[model samples]
Target: AQSVSQHNHHVILSEAASLELGCNYSYGGTVNLFWYVQYPGQHLQLLLKYFSGDPLVKGIKGFEAEFIKSKFSFNLRKPSVQWSDTAEYFCAVIYSSASKIIFGSGTRLSIRP
Candidate 1:
């Protein structure tokens, strides 16, 4: 079974501050990683994903993630965050042999204006 872990349960930052959320998985096989964000009243939206090809993947809303195979990590990052970016971020993984997506505990990002 595969599982995702998000070290930070809550994060606070001011507007324009850099953001980096930690995300790691426990799978060693072929897998796909994804970063999803859920706003205060909206559904989950795909931020970014890494399936194959380039290790660095750019996602919506100026977000990006790098697939580090050796470390089993797919950390999400953004150079500058905005108040609108405030949301609950989730790290997910889907193994090639599995049909379900394993999601992390989730990290709540709070941005101050």
Candidate 2:
């Protein structure tokens, strides 16, 4: 079965600190990977995504993720953080173009200023 797993249930960071969130997935064939962020009281927004081409993709707000197909890992990273970066991050995988997205347990990031 295809599934997505987020290893970190919660993360705490200080302003200007670096951030990394672990994500892994299980699928047989090619898949689409995505990182979505939901700020408090806001809708989920795409942080980054990988479909094809470059294994490393960059997203909004200085966020980036690397897709390692062999390991089935798509880890998100941020070089620097801010107080407003506090949000819930979700890793998702889609087996096919029309398949439903499987979302991992979200990681809630709290940034202390």
Candidate 3:
């Protein structure tokens, strides 16, 4: 079965630290990748997405992800993170062959003020 994997279960960093969360999916056919962030007491929101065209897509809040077809990876990165960036990040994929979206367990990001 196709699935998404988030390498980091939990990540802790001080303010202004660079952040990189690894995400990889197992799918052979065409797929769409997305990164979602859920803040404390809030619903999940779209952070960034890669559907077509450019492999690198930028989203809200200075977050970006690269869709590497060869590696089956869509890793999220931010140059510097702030305390407000603390949230749970999820990697999701939608395979063309399937109608449902598959999501990774998610990575919890805790930023130290």
Candidate 4:
């Protein structure tokens, strides 16, 4: 029953607007979490991560997330986004070496200028 799912498949925003995309997983063990963003024709970059320690973590481009162990979720949030933030957001889980990293279907975020 180890699976992760994204609720938001696509999102659109203006010049400055709040953003909140949901990510839920079904793992019952200690695991690493990550959020990756891929720009148009660009490779995937680490946005943030929750390996151990703190439950709240931040990353590049003014993005942050809070890990809720009870809910098995690591939802991403951003206050006031920009046009450059327009890209595909993916939520991934770090599993054992045998299992490759898995990415959500992706949330296409389009920013209107």
Residue lDDT tens for model 4, 48-98: 998999999998889999899999899999998999999999998876542
Q: Rate the local accuracy (lDDT) of all candidates.
A: 0.95, 0.94, 0.95, 0.88
RMSD of each: 0.8, 1.2, 0.6, 1.5
Clashing pairs in 3: none
lDDT of 2 by residue, 1-113 (tens): 88899999999999999999999998668899999999999998998999999999999999999999889999999999999999999999989744698999999999999
TM-score winner between 2 and 4, please give it: 2
Q: What digit string (tens of lDDT, one per residue) describes model 3 on residues 1-113? A: 89999999999999999999999999659999999999999999999888899999999999999999999999999999999999999999999999999999999999999
List the candidate numbers ranked by TM-score, top first.
3, 1, 2, 4
* Candidate 1 lDDT, 1-112, residue by residue in tens: 5789999999999999999999999965999999999999999999998999999999998999999999999999999999999999999999998899999999999999
Model 3 worst lDDT window (10 residues): 24-33
lDDT of 1 at 26: 93
Query: TM-scores across all candidates?
Result: 0.97, 0.96, 0.98, 0.92
lDDT of 4 at 24: 88
Q: Please tell me which model should have the higher lDDT, number 1 or number 2.
A: 1
Model 4, residue 108: what's the lDDT?
90
Stretches off by above 4 angstroms in model 3 are none
Estimate the overall C-alpha local distance difference test score of candidate 2.
0.94
Where's the lowest-lDDT run of ten residues in candidate 4?
A: 94-103
The ten-residue window of minimal lDDT in model 1 covers 24-33
